[model samples]
Target: MTATPVDTRPLAIDARGLVKRFDKTLAVDGVDIAIPEGAIYGILGPNGAGKTTTLRMLLGIIDPDAGTRSVLGASNPQDVARRIGYLPEERGLYPAMKCDEAIGFMGALRGLPLKVGKERGRELLEAHGLGHAIDKQIRQLSKGMAQTVQLLGTLVHRPKLVVFDEPFSGLDAINQGKLEVLIRGLADEGTTVIFSTHVIAHAERLCEGIAIIAGGKVPFTGPVDEARDRIPAQVRLETRSADGPWRAALPGDTRRVGNYWSFPLPETGVEPLLKALIDGDAGILSLSIERAGLHDAFVAIAGEAAARDMVTRGGGEAA
Candidate 1:
């Protein structure tokens, strides 16, 4: 008998048919995903879109009503608890704890020796440009500084996988950019990073693969470019005259919006259409093609009304 070749690329997080309920409400429904090792993956959706519930399920914080999952190839997350790092959306820290001590404490919970944790914590804080504040109390730091300390704590043990929930919620523009760099750095160093965020721009710029969940269902998943392909490209053109023979060259579904004529880019290409318009003596004022973004993709996958509801983060039991 021939020996089979081994498959070495195992998924860091494998979840299938996950379902959860809170009383009569369906918090998560039939969710499934395979997060590859050494990749940056994102769970993106509006607030209460079942994103938090799904993360909770994956971490074994809350048992799923149905389906199964594995974390770091283990059947239970607790089995590999020390190998995974998690930063919940709700920030937590002892107000009186020193900056370095807070980070060490977080590592201690994951079984890292307190002495090692403290040393590593100091190293991380210094590297992150907070060297002067290492001994400051958590309550003494600014909001952004405190958040950074919490993030450093999450990585003090050097877990194989890390998850951040709404990591950008309160960050300023400069800090947000810094955090993006940090996440990328982690992935470059061979750590599998997974995060949940309502902000689509972060996923667009950082994630290699993403799952877009809404109303407890994932409408789209896979590569970022693939998700964007769901929405057709559009063209916007404006002419000095609204009525002319050139109008006939436009797509049948074309419509006038504001001062411009908008229509879907056709299969034949815009070159032919532009030539026809010029031949008909039309004055082309302005023109350009608009590529779809994540927001547009979300709206296309989930209906406009549902997307609107998502933007509002409807209901009190948020995901």
Candidate 2:
């Protein structure tokens, strides 16, 4: 008998058929997700798409009206809560508390020793260029600085899994870049990082996989590249000859702007078209093929209305 190879990779989060309703509103319907261990995953959608509700259910902060979920293999997330670090969408810290104290308090809530939490808090502050504000009152720091302190607190316990709900909402560009670096570092150290965001650019740049929710329903979920691949690669062509038989080979939807013609790559592939263009003596000055980005994929998979909502609400901020 031949021995079978076993797949050993573990799942950090597994959810199936999740549903939630508030009165007449169906917030989430039949949503399923599987996230692998140590992966950076993103929950992307427009505003009011139940992204927050889904996250809350996963963390056991709220129960799903229907379906099952497991976090770190536990059916009840609270049973393993100590192993998870969560940063809620709403940022909050006691105004009178010192920066280090606040971080320590957050860690202590998750079962870390106050002394150790404070020590780590100080170190984190120093590493992130907030050492000078370590003893300052929360009210004393700027809004951006306070938010950073709270985020550091979320990691003080060094949990195996970290979940951030709309973490970049109030951050400036520089801080946003720093946060991205921090997230990457955590993943490098074998921590599973999950975040919910309206910003498609962040997901495109950071996530290995993503789940796109629309109107409280999941439209698509899988690897970032897979989602992007739903749409064909775009082609940009610049030819010296404006008119020729080669034009017949171009896609019907091809559009011209000045000297450049742009369209989706033909299904028959570029080789046949290139031959036709050359044979017709249509001088090809510049030609390039570019993959469709997450933005385009979102519009294709989630519908134009959802894409419009994303932009009008907040998605345009990072685009």
Which residue pairs clash in candidate 1? 48-319
How do the residues 65-177 of candidate 2 rate in per-residue lDDT, one tens digit apiece? 89999999999999999999999887899999998999999999999999999999999999999999999999999999999999999999999999999988879999999
For residue 171, model 2's alpha carbon misses the true position, in angstroms, by 0.8
Q: Number of the top candidate by TM-score?
A: 2
lDDT for each residue of candidate 1 in 1-319, tens digit (9 for 90 to 100)? 2464443677999999999999999988999888889888899887878888999899888899999999999989989989999998888789899999999999999999999999999999999899999999999999999999999999999999999988888889999999999999999999999999877789989998898888899877777777887877899998887788888899999989999989988888799999988998788898999878977887888677666765676333284
TM-score for predicted model 1 compared with the true structure: 0.87
* TM-score, one value per model: 0.87, 0.93
lDDT of each: 0.88, 0.92
